[model samples]
Target: RQFGEGGAELFHSHRAGGIVLPTGTVRVEKLSASFTELPGFEDGAWWVQDAAASLPARLFGDIKGLRVADLCAAPGGKTAQLILGGANVTAVDISKNRLARLSQNLERLGLSAEIVQADLLKYEPEQLFDAVLLDAPCSSTGTVRRHPDVPWTKTAADIEKLADLQRRLLARAVTLVKPGGRIVFSNCSLDPLEGEALYRAFLAGTADIVDDPLRPGEIAGIDPFLTPQGTLRTTPADLELGSPERSGLDGFFAARFRRAG
Candidate 1:
């Protein structure tokens, strides 16, 4: 709607499926056709991303004109969100192929960002950013609804390894942001080891970081997903839409932190 795509009516008129999200995202409950086959998709009115995938970027809130580093930002959904939110973004990804896809998406949306292909562990920037969004890679157990093969393909060992990798990426993310800047760490793993446990351990070791919890009423339809720790955790069993099949979002977990100045 922000891009003048005409909201749900646009999809309805085209006989497509869509439902509005609190974050202004149009969730297509049932796609009548492929994303490219959907009307206005080629025109870049919107991009394809799960509603849960959109949360981590929103955690920064009102990032207009802020310099933000989007680490591991391939496929560019969150990066596009940052650009549309008026942030100057540098999208860094390790995969060249993925970065190419990200570039194409940005071009289609008529948005631009500094796209860098480099490992987060080895990449160095001239200056720190005002904010950082680390959507770390995980076991992807959260997306089993769409990709049901996730559990079969990924083992518990994979989750453990990914959790360790996320911790390293998160630490690196903190270093890329300036003091007093905020960071939103997120992953699609439902495992606590990759979500709450990892974040808590990081906090225990890092003294200069403080929790920046997501408060109720900040985001519509999000109260049910807020945790006692102030983090956002959405499971496959959450978000009662209407029917069984239409309910719930991807099992995603997100937590925000502010580096002490």
Candidate 2:
């Protein structure tokens, strides 16, 4: 029954019956329908972002006037959050199409950011930032609920390729932060290879990296699977049927790292 390259079509149609968040009371059905039919789905009243994904921006502490760079900021979910938090944000991504979407989202939210379309590996900013958010692309295993197609479309080889890219992106993002600034590296994948594994590797290669902790009670009703070593993860199963509060969130993994003085 698997269809499409890597059986993506088959995987997309198969919904896991069990709810990952057994105690969650959020209504799963209404959330899904709202996302698709919401008036601003395309116009950007709200962007598809996980509750965990919002943690990295908070780790920055305070950014009222600080210069911040959001590397790989296509479709600008994190970028929008940063701007809303009061940082002067600069968003960069390699894909022109996605950048257009990011721009639109910023516009809809009544926020503004300097949008650059360029590969972070080769692009250079005019100055270092107070903080940087590198939400790198990965195997996306942590996002199976929203993107079940990922398991079918991606392979071990694909994960390896993404890991390589993540390393490069991390290296470049490090260079963009000031000596005392912070960098948050995150992905929507559960593979330790993408989440904790890559983070450990980055710390091993660089001496300035330090773990940044999440604020108290930032994640109150989220699924337990989403929390690990201060990182937050969300899955589709976390949404509760019949309840309308915790539904409609995509799975995500996030970690915050600071550049040491």
Candidate 3:
């Protein structure tokens, strides 16, 4: 409750598990606290989410009352982000089961979205949205710390397979947004083939879309992680130089695209 009483690199979990930072996060100082123990846990002050995983949703500066689509959204973190910004979101996920969890989470947080169970590859909306957030499925190499078995279970071939799925999903996302609307494509994979390379290919084929590059200070402390092409790229290797153990952010890549009419 009193986050800033003393500042010691404590972070607040904005439910990618953590956000707000230093003063706020799921934990208090070096101590790991249970979800039930954290302030507002029962009241839905926030959900558990990795700090890095939460960044992509902030790409949209403000969108009060706008229609947005959160594709592949389940156990909805980004969906919550969009809702907090006052977007009327259609949260779509192929897994009806996961969407159930999403619904429960939002209900606890006292937020709501038009939940839909549909596959990103084939689900067709009756109309386009003003914005689309495609946190596309990938090999998830970026989240190895949270799920340690990821690296061991995944291979280059696995990345190729997931990359293909990402490609198809992003292609469908492009179709789902209103002309001149924006799309933020993100994946929790450090692989360029799945993140950066996918964007490059999409650019080549689509004449009506242009890169909506991220700028400096857009998201605090993210300057070093940005690519020359204006995408945020992170890795497990990007931990703070001195404190290798404690200070770290997840490996993630995100790029915004605008459909140019």
Best by TM-score: 1
lDDT agreement with native, every candidate:
0.85, 0.69, 0.78
Q: Candidate 2 lDDT, tens digit per residue, 1-261? A: 101122222122224111223322212223334453643444444455555565455556678999999999988878877886789999999999999988877776667999999989898888999999988988777667666677888888888888888888898898899987888887777677776777777777888777775654554443354445666655555544565544545556666777888
Show the lowest summed lDDT stretch of 10 residues, model 3.
1-10
Model 3 scores a C-alpha lDDT of 0.78
Best by lDDT: 1
Provide the global lDDT of candidate 2 against the true structure. Answer: 0.69
Query: TM-score rank, highest first?
Result: 1, 3, 2
**What local lDDT does model 2 show for residue 193?**
75
Clashing pairs counted in every model: 0, 6, 18
Cα lDDT tens digits, model 1, 145-175, are 8788888997888888999999999988888
Model 1 ranges with Cα > 4 A deviation = 1-9, 12-14
lDDT, residue 117, model 3: 96
How many clashing pairs does model 3 include?
Answer: 18
For all predicted structures, in order, the TM-scores are 0.93, 0.76, 0.86
So what's the TM-score on candidate 1?
Answer: 0.93
